[model samples]
Target: MTADPTTGISSFDPQRALALAADTFQNEAEALLAIRAGLDASFADVVRLMLSCRGRVVVMGMGKSGHVGRKIAATLASTGTPAMFVHPGEASHGDLGMVTLQDVVMAISNSGESDELNVIVPVLKRLNVPLVAMTGRAGSTLARHADHVLLCAVEREACPLNLAPTTSTTAQMAMGDALAVALLDARGFHEQDFARSHPGGALGRKLLMHVRDLMRSGDDLPRVAPDARFLQMLHEMSAKGLGFTAVVDAEDRVQGIFTDGDLRRLIERGTDLRAFHAGDVMHRQPRCVRDDVLAVEAAAVMEQHRVTSVLVVDAQGRLVGAINSNDLMRAKVI
Candidate 1:
């Protein structure tokens, strides 16, 4: 049975339901492809203009385009492009004063004719500031007034009524992302640079946090000498609370490591704990990292080697500290 068109109450029509969802995706995809084709040397022009701006790249739009512009501005700012969004309506009222000859403006309008934006374009021109217009209408007033043009036309809206700004907005968003990424690459923005803009997030922790920042050092480290009894290593592991203990030589160079897994395996083998020493029951080449390594990289080492804990070392390969899954979790880099 066919589903109700008005309320969209389906009567279990699998083919129709799938087609409905697929059509929206297909339309949006086609719109994005059209934008990709529409991009030309003008894209390079805008990028060069933006790169030359000593001040911020100011973004402006109206309605749905405004929302997209704001996101675009934010993306640009975070990716090292130095950008901000100014509401076109507000610009006409007073915000137009924010525009300087040092700045570049990116204005978006599907129709290429927002009055609020139009009112401010003349002021920008008078200030000799470059304006790049993103619009579907090539012959639009906004396009005619702009110093450069970026076309964002769509074949049709994804909306069944062909009225809502669905496909057009998607195209705009994709274009903004593309532009931001292009600028990011041009500026040679690195992971550390990205982390600087997002210091409070997991990515920041991953990029900026070091192994020493989260490792158990000094007395906090679970350590036992190679000649130490298995019972002594167990006591050290428990006292340190890292579920494992490293076996080191007299010079404090790591010899091996004994973990909870080692204990379990030894117990399953019916070996007498009292009979074994640290050197006899420990993993000689345990997964280990340096104190100065990125904590995220340490976590990756642990994961790739399938270990719960890693011994932290120094330049001389001597045991200095230790870290485990718990430390990574505490640092939010897991």
Candidate 2:
């Protein structure tokens, strides 16, 4: 019988609904904390097994566990641990060859009784591969066959129906993150190493890119002789659009620099432009950096001095290149 959807308006209490949401969040938080408290030597064993492996870490699971396995594999791969996801059901259909004796297999299952995963256990054992099992039950068959068991047991499912996988998956995901971080720390993975692995990401650009890769070189650099007229320096600065011009000596060594700030000071002091050369109004011994410096370091220098541009010079103090805040901005290094 069809009934009005809004007929039970008064029966649906708003206060009760708010209390239910709060209780659900509090319960899930407690379950996660309980799972964290249970971590022991087995967790370290899993890290050691993965570290000792000469091949990739093969992750396997079924249903929702499979989804979490895929994410864990991706995180591990990006964080310096070579890992890949393999569905247990597909492993039986010739994907088992992907597993090698040198590889470590991490199988994920809540009850540790997933039929698909069970089917691959014998084959993995036959291959003599190391197995790291992530499951709720430490005494299950999957755990019994594994070399190391990572228990991700949650007190209860967050789902109101208590049938869907929710809190368990969250616990599993958190454990996976912990494993990846442990491996990352053990391997001494640095930002440069991470950048090498993720060259297309922003962090990679900041760590891997050098100033020479983004700085203005050759004709693009704005330079004028120390004895050059103020109008000539202005023309060079205007042409380069770096808001500054370098004043160099005959040896190509930077004697000083004229920036927009210098121009403002000149105007405020009412200096005669007609008699002035670049050296007469330039800032002497301006801040400079080497061409080989990282773009991230260049950004740091700019921020340190509160300047927008920096001159790139060689060990001999000769002007070689130049870079501005705009360059760093364009490179996404800022």
Q: Best TM-score goes to which candidate?
A: 2
lDDT tens digits, residue span 210-315, model 1 = 9998988998988889889878888998998888898999999989988888899989999888988999989988888999999998989988988888899999
Flag regions of model 2 displaced more than 4 Å: 1-17
Model 1 vs truth, CA RMSD = 3.8
Query: Compared with the true structure, what per-residue lDDT tens digits does model 2 show for residues 1-334?
Result: 2345779444556787888788778877998889888878988988998898899999999999999999999999999999999989989999988888789999999999999998889888888898889999989989999888999887788777788898899889999999999999999988889999988789999889998999998999999998898889899999988899998988889998999998998889987887899889899989999888898898999999999999998878899999999999888887
For candidate 1, what is the total of clashing residue pairs? 0
TM-score of each candidate structure, all chains considered together:
0.82, 0.90
Q: All models: lDDT? A: 0.90, 0.90
Clashes of 2: 0
